[model samples]
Target: MSIYFWGLVISIAVYLLVGNYAGRKVQGLDDYYVAGRKAPTLLIVGTLVASFLSTNAFLAETGFAYDGYAFLMLALVAVNTSGYVIGALFFGRFVRRSESLTIPEFFAKRFDSRAMQVLAGYTTVIGLTAYLLAVTQGGSILISDVVGIPYGVALVMVWLGYMVFTLYSGSRGVVLTDTIMFLLFTLVSIIALPYLLGEGGGWNATLTALASSEAKPGIIAWHGLTGEGALWSSGKDALIWALMLGASWSLVLAVSPWQTSRYLMARSEHVVVRSACIAGLVLAALYVVLLFGGAAVNLVNPNISPSERVMVWAGMNMMPAFIGTLLISGIMAAALSSCSTFLSLIGFSVSNDIIKSQQWTEHKSLRMSRYIMFAAALVSLILAYFQPPAVMWITYFAGTLFASSWGPVAFMSIWSRRISAPAAFVGMLAGFLINIGAKLLDNAGVLSLPVYLDPFILGFFSNVICILVISRFTQPTKAALAYFETIRQTPKEELDPAEVKKTLIWPVIVMISGLTIAGLLFVFYAMPYAAAVGREFSLFSGESLLSIGYGLSVFCVGLLAFWQVRRVYGRKTAQRATTR
Candidate 1:
């Protein structure tokens, strides 16, 4: 009856349809898990976007923007860029070549140890569950806020909807539905950005309010160690590190078990590399919009009661009632796309890593994965019902654990040949335990250290130190050497060097256009802030014609890329490879 409920219903219907459609293809395990490994670049791109940008992002990113003690966009830019580059440079080639279904499979093959496979699998399952819990928390918060329903009830409704889609369709459903959901979500933001900017006094009033008020620093300022509190809190440095090295390392090395699930869908290394770069740039641009929206909210209405309501508040204030409903639907779509993947990942991990034995066949394995899905969703739902109101903390813990626990193992697998099985096992153990221990210690006030020195930072170094020290006493396995060889071996099916060289022109153009747009957005924010304090620039004026020029550049590059794609398609007969 409420707008939130209606939005929820519409989102549910779309997902259900996707599930039903995808179910027709689920003849066995492969289709259920990785869509028969035939996913085109577009669907893979959608799933990547949807899975990473969960409800927590919608809430925390905007909340962080409104918190105004940090330049959230800069952190986003750093981490995302680092993650993409890392993926493109190293992990992409390794993972694409392995041809494994799960991250643990890669580990098992690389390390020649079933134990390492099991360890990686369980660690991913547990870590990702925490991440999903955080995502669900944000979704529940939105539902509760809109319909005045209990959090537990809202959580159940959201979880049940996710289960129907994930269980029936698995990753196949995730890819298809995510594509639709991503488009809807992106459209909502694009539509809302212009309308909100116009209604909130054409950016002038918002800028003045943001600059003059003392509620918080603007979005570009550091988040921690304010006027007097700088002596007590390490939020500033922690925020910066989280955005920079932390994001990049975690994302790039993530191909192990976490992102291996996504890359498995891509047909070749080239597709994965190109898609990741494009996705990274697109996410960066989206963050700029979301950052602007979040900042604008605080500028127009400095009352930050419930942090999660930043987007909702802006929507209600700026748009018509009907459009407000559509915005909420967009949020629901974003949340659902993420939740589906979380469910699928948890299920797959539990089935393949925990319950099923190595002797199991494909059909049995797939069935077990579905059961794991049910059990995981049920456990998370129960946890969500009792979770504390601070949804952001859970998300932080999840990200920290994943980054530290898997980051080292994944990095060593590709980067080093000397890392032994025993060393890998012990390193993962030390990293996982140290990370958890660090968090517990900090929370209990048992030790007083910089917050940045938490489990993530500690565990990362611990894995490295443990592996290096232990490997000195151990021998490398044959599988480890084999994996190294695989990395060295050039694929027979790789794209033609000459053809790829031609495609390079478009990607370069796109990159330049993307960078130029980023520059304009930065200036957009800076000029408004400067103008609020009555400072005017000479000659170049922050509001110069260059912004429009950059916009046109993006269009031109897009056209060029389209033409290249068509030309490549036209030359398929001549360029087609003669061998697999």
Candidate 2:
């Protein structure tokens, strides 16, 4: 057998072993759902990054980069980082404090309505099912290409791997394996960049080839570029694209069931906050490397059509046999991490929220969770087999669904007391319906809506308007008002102001220094150079600019990793000493 096949087999065996080990520890619903809320900051960071940075990063975004839409990388980084930052600053502590098992449960409790909980639960399942389908399809395509198998067989294999892990280990298995997968994928992704750049004869040569080739004009342009112009228009559409995409994705990260569940799994609010920051930084650094690698892949082979397959082609052709095997394995890891997360979320929503099985024991609930996961996996497999639209479209659809249905209600529940249950329900419904209408119209070609003004933007605004307008004409129940007061008065752990200042000092310095350097580079070098070169300006050249940027990013990421590891282990050491 080939080395690639061996690698695949070994990786699968390792994952199954890990899942079995974790499965033994699953004693109750608490352990199954949120790992008993004892996960450390590092584990939370790993799972959060692994779950969110799935095939979307490896497949979709890389495909965009391969097609010379490198600007999408910037847009994605800006939006995704903003999402993490907002979640850490505003939503993390609140969600952690709520002590809710799921986002839908939080909504149900905050609104004082079981109906709202059921609605939220159903919506979560439907939206996340769509997401699961996309991830599954992406995984199948990658695997089928690598193993030289039929798409149907690959689809079944992918489903089986994801479902088995999810069924056995639940969140515990998911988080543990996610941490391992994150490390593998991050290393492989970073290493792949230099290899591709080298294969393309370095940055300048790569850019020259891209510019001279029959690729899209302005393929190197930072603004006004897209994969299909489905989510962004051309020319003068950059600002709106950034705003809508940023806002919509940010809300999804803050309020989506799968994302919010990570916060609740944290050991403490402090861990939640720190993990968010670390995850954001790690993700930003990784994307810088991965996107650059994807762009460089065009130099290796510019004619790889259906662009999504470019990364897979690069893995097979642009690297050594062992590295190629590892890269494909990393892609599998990404797929499994995300697929398992969504499966687990669906299981929880159905068993805990929708059914509301009060008479079941912890053991029974655990078994039911497994059964639900299996069923969800089967459903996702069917969807993947039918072949969905492009992965990014489905991703955006699911993201919009979550953002419209849950975003406004989540923000209002925590920040405002005047939003009645009726208002919340109606607003959520209106947002959802509007989003559906917009999508149908766009898909049917009945309206050529500017991609910048996508469904999420419209639905979000609709939700906000409905809440404000309807709440003005309605009264909140006394019980709901009391609950709001209780939430308002919930005391959080206070950090020392001096400690906070000390923690802020280094990051503030680093930010200022980095921004200052960037400004100087742009003002003195990039602008003058670009103006001189005119429309032929090559952004990838100029004294190894891309190399320097990527190097610094990697260095910063190393420092962040070291700092986090030291902090976590230092605490352990101190605790051991005290015990002695």
Candidate 3:
């Protein structure tokens, strides 16, 4: 084999060995499912970062940058990071304290109904399956591009790699391997960004080239409905606003069910809390680098599309072979980490959440999970082989469906005392059906909703309305109220000695510091470029009191809202209530 191929093989083998070794202590379904609740903050953070930075981001986002500008990356980063902030400030604490094995488990506990479990399990599995296929296809493309392998062979290899880790170590292996992958990807992104930028030109020169180049690529322009490439446009400003609001809501909502299993596996609530903070920082940094890479691509070429192969093309064309190899490996790492997590998650839902509930023995249950994993992976592999090279909009549709169906159910199950079993059932079912219809319509290209009124937003409101309307007519059972009381009244575990040092102060400091740096970068680098290119941006210069006053007014209002939430919920108590 060539050196590049050898390096790829060696890297994959090393990660697999290291992961399995570190996760050897996972003893049973509990450990496999929840990692024995022993993960530290750093490990939790690493897995969270790796899980979120999946093959989709590498392929889809890069393709977007190639076609459009850095705006797509910037838009998504802002949206997702805002979701993290919302989660940490409101829902993260609650989720950590819930102590449930899966999102369905939480549903069963909070709603006092097995029907909710089965329903949620069904919705979660379906949404996750779509995401799984997306990851698998992306991985297949990467392997085929880098190693010159046939798509079928690459698909099988990817499936085998994921199955091995998921079957043996479960969530334990998922977290450990995810962490390693995150670190590797971070290094590669940093290395690749500079190499690409230096090759293209220094920042200023690159910006000039971009301005004078074909079609002014790299500017935050958009396609309205009457304009070019209008998928469904609100306006030039509509893209950012829709992306920031819609995408942020989806992230928070999806993370609740999607990552709830991993969060429940945390050693302690404090561990998960620290992990969330760290994950946010890593995500913010990763976004910045990706934005830079996207901008660098604009300096080289425009008219790029959002596809996995596009990223590989950019790396190979722009960077040295050695550097390109490393970046490809990093992208592969992202793909593998995401693939393994999906396999484990779907395996858990199918076996524990569905099949094993019919009374399989422990040995049988383990075997069942593995079998299910194998089956799911096989299906994903088949899909990958047949998938078109064009971008798939259904992946985001799946994400939207997940958010709409589970977000309200998750939020109410823990926080709202008024939510009855009927309410929960109606909320989940109504939201799910609406999202499904919208997704199908979108796929059929029949009726595209307005930018702000897409299926996710529609379904989210449907869920809210279902809960509110149902709750008014039907009173909550005393038992359901008692469950909410348990969540609210329970005292949190005291921090361990090691946790005392690692938990509260440093995490806060690090997160704040990271946000500050990201904000500064946005202001100094991102904002200036946007303003120069006829984008809508405002900044305060000396004696521009009007802008300063407006900024302060916005900040003050936000602070007041936060203060009210704190007063009513008692600092992270809203999250605790939601998780309950």
- Full-model lDDT for every candidate: 0.69, 0.75, 0.66
Give the per-residue lDDT digits (tens) of candidate 1, residues 23-136.
Answer: 888987778877887777678778877777777667877776676633434444444443643554456657767777677777888888889888887888888788778888
Mark the regions of model 2 whose C-alpha exceeds 4 Å error after superposition. Answer: 211-214, 224-233, 489-580
Candidate 1 runs further than 4 Å off: 217-225, 229-253, 497-506, 534-580
Question: Which TM-score value belongs to model 1?
Answer: 0.88
Q: Can you give the lDDT of residue 558 in candidate 3?
A: 33
lDDT of 2 by residue, 232-302 (tens): 45534754665577678878877788888898888865577667666766776677577767877876677
Alpha-carbon TM-score of each model against the true structure: 0.88, 0.87, 0.86
| C-alpha lDDT of residue 327 in model 2 | 87
Ten consecutive residues with minimal summed lDDT in candidate 2? 490-499
RMSD of each: 5.0, 5.9, 5.0
lDDT of 3 by residue, 114-134 (tens): 778778878878888788888
